[model samples]
Target: MLAKHSKNKKISDKAFITSGKAKLAISKYGKENVINATLGVLYNDLEEIYTFDIVDQEYRKLSSQDLYGYASSITGDENFKTSVKKIVLGENIESNFPNIYTDVISTPGGTGAIYNTFKNYIEYGDKVLLPNFMWSSYKLISGEAGGGYDCYSLFDSKNNFNLLSFEKKVLELSEIQKNLVIVINDPCQNPTGYTLTEDEWEKIMDILKRACKKTNIVLLNDIAYRDFDNKALEFKNIFKDIPENLLIIIAFSISKSFCSYGLRVGAQLALSSSHRVIEQFREASAYTCRGIWSNVSRAGMQMLSNIILNKNKYLELKIELDKSIKLLKRRSDIFINESKDIGLKILPYKSGFFITIPFKKGIDSKVSLELEKKNIFALVMEEGIRIAICSIPSHKFKGLASKIKEVLIEIE
Candidate 1:
């Protein structure tokens, strides 16, 4: 007799291996000296601003009973949860749009959130639509969910996600798949750092609405680096009027926003008009949560709650964050402008911590590895090198640009 659940047994490819550039940078530059333009981490000094006195004191005052109690059982302690909900949902709910629900469950990190959401919604043989160039986690999570579906390429010859091409793919997928989830990363996309313009978002949303009107589909908006853009709230506001027919889900993370990566706190907000549908979604998500990590880190939740509850402190923290974001933008502007001056080609990047540089001759990953010999670290994607700009110090921008130019010359 065949062993039960044998079909589900498979080798794990979900763990994201660190990029080669990251390892080289850490080894050569001693971690601190090397500019880490590889990960989506904010390097601004703002910890003091986010520090909370009241929360600390209150936390200390809590007895053993509080530690063991359910968060919802505390009748008067709803404000912490409410404040975080507001920040994550933004103007999407304030304008009478379908609001995002926060009580579904928690996860160790945003990746966990993605995995749980996929587990809850996807079934074997079901198809999930994704952009050709997306965060690698989407593929890993989707595979772990059930090993179903295929990715549709969204890139043009110029290596951009073209609207016309994307729409064509959606139309084709609609013909074959009844249950579909389309994932879109907006505002400082990981690995690419491409932020969609308001007009671009509008066009895509309109097309998705039209397509889903005739088919069963769900839209998952992964705003992992939403905080990197100064106008994150404004961009989120544009989604307020999305049609109710299209099932919408927003995955929000505090990792990049508050520089709380180690905390691993993230939330999934499901937007739907049907109470029954939302309820089922919540139940299924909770089940997945139990099966996986069995809920998020309690300490992480407390830290986030503390930061949100103290408004004055939060504003102070935002001010410091604003300063860091401005500095990051300055570094990005320097890199892009200097590269252009030297006749080097790069993608159009407005917001986000990364910039993509496409090689004219189409170099392979092995040749890209040679970049490490010059002390320039970068994540090599299929199209080009993705340089993380957030960690690059402002003073060193010019020197880094010059080195990259020299590398290009040598490679050519």
Candidate 2:
């Protein structure tokens, strides 16, 4: 017999399923005939998943013990945590936040980091706040933690961050919930690829300060696509001088940045002005890790630490990653320009793996199904069709927007 929480659980990952269908079509019609933009992973010109050579080289250098041995602690290896902080925060953690205490705990991947945060911070039956258009897994993760979710309008009429809607939701939730957990996917958000401006971030911090007066808050900043945005770190300085009642948890992933998607290496970097709070976070998070996955990939963690700590290796990885980012940009540029030429309406995209094409509400599935008839596979969502620019090659992007427009017209 199934437990109460386990009953009635049905999960279907449309992205992977659509990707599978695209693969079948490619096998039948060839890659040139079908456009597979379902899965979000960087693909080379030859349509192969792109990975940094430096990662492979470093991984090969690890000893047998390094590859197979368990991590020293449930939290993860010391070197792994240090390297993650260096790469993500870009400074020595001690000096950078002398007054704010910090801690890092390794997780299976960015997914795990977010899951742990949800499980620990989100009270039973509580709801987390998310963007209206977001990665679909956030809702599933919250549900798994025995919590529900609400959303704030991601964009206003001006196609900018809707601070008014965001503040209203935060304050409203704070009034009811003892702890408010808010997830902000910034500097290249999923589905829409929109980034918040500096002014928006300042205003957001003000909102959090106001909300904190009513209830304790946990801000989960999911920067899974941070490495793709060349200017993402420009706004990192906003983390300083946070309130004691507020805790910021950054979900850092090695999967996207290092092109180690299957390696399952990620970490939770937590910041708080209170020492006791930081300690509690470390202990509770490590305990959760022991209960769930127990430990992450040792080889994956070692490879990342080796690459980030070594200057030459890190430089090489950066150069390779830059080329990948450029390729993604080229692909996205073609799609955006073609969409403009054909009068296809897409969301305001800055930089990221995905570009969302919004249509009439409740017709996203129909639109995507229509596109599937033409052998173009994309993830259907409540908001729109998400074109994974990272999966499609540069040359294949030509005329895609026009074809998608054709599908939209047919659906309507």
| The candidate that achieves the highest lDDT relative to the unseen native structure | 2
lDDT of 1 by residue, 1-412 (tens): 5576456555532112334555567687775555555555655432122323444454466556555554442111344346555666643354545453334345666777677677777667676777655676687678778745566654566756688877887778777776667888877876667777777778888888778767766778788888778876453555655554566777777677766677676777667655666787777877776666665655556656666667776676677667767877888888888987887777767687788776654664553556666665566666667786776567657767667667766775
- Candidate 1, 231: how far from true, in Å? 1.3
Candidate 2 weakest lDDT stretch, 10 residues: 232-241
- Pairs in steric clash, model 2: none
- What value of lDDT does candidate 2 attain over all alpha carbons? 0.90
Tell me the tens digit of each residue's lDDT in model 2 across 39-60. Answer: 8788888888898899999999
lDDT of 2 at 220: 96
Flag clash pairs in model 1.
37-388
Q: After superposition, how far is residue 149 of candidate 1 from its true place, in Å?
A: 5.4
Q: What are the runs in model 2 whose C-alpha is more than 4 Å off?
A: 234-236
Q: How accurate is candidate 1 locally (lDDT)?
A: 0.65
Error of 1 at 202 (Å): 1.7
**Candidate 2 at residue 214, lDDT?**
96
For candidate 2, the per-residue lDDT at 93 reads: 65
**On a 0 to 100 scale, what is the lDDT of residue 345 in model 1?**
75
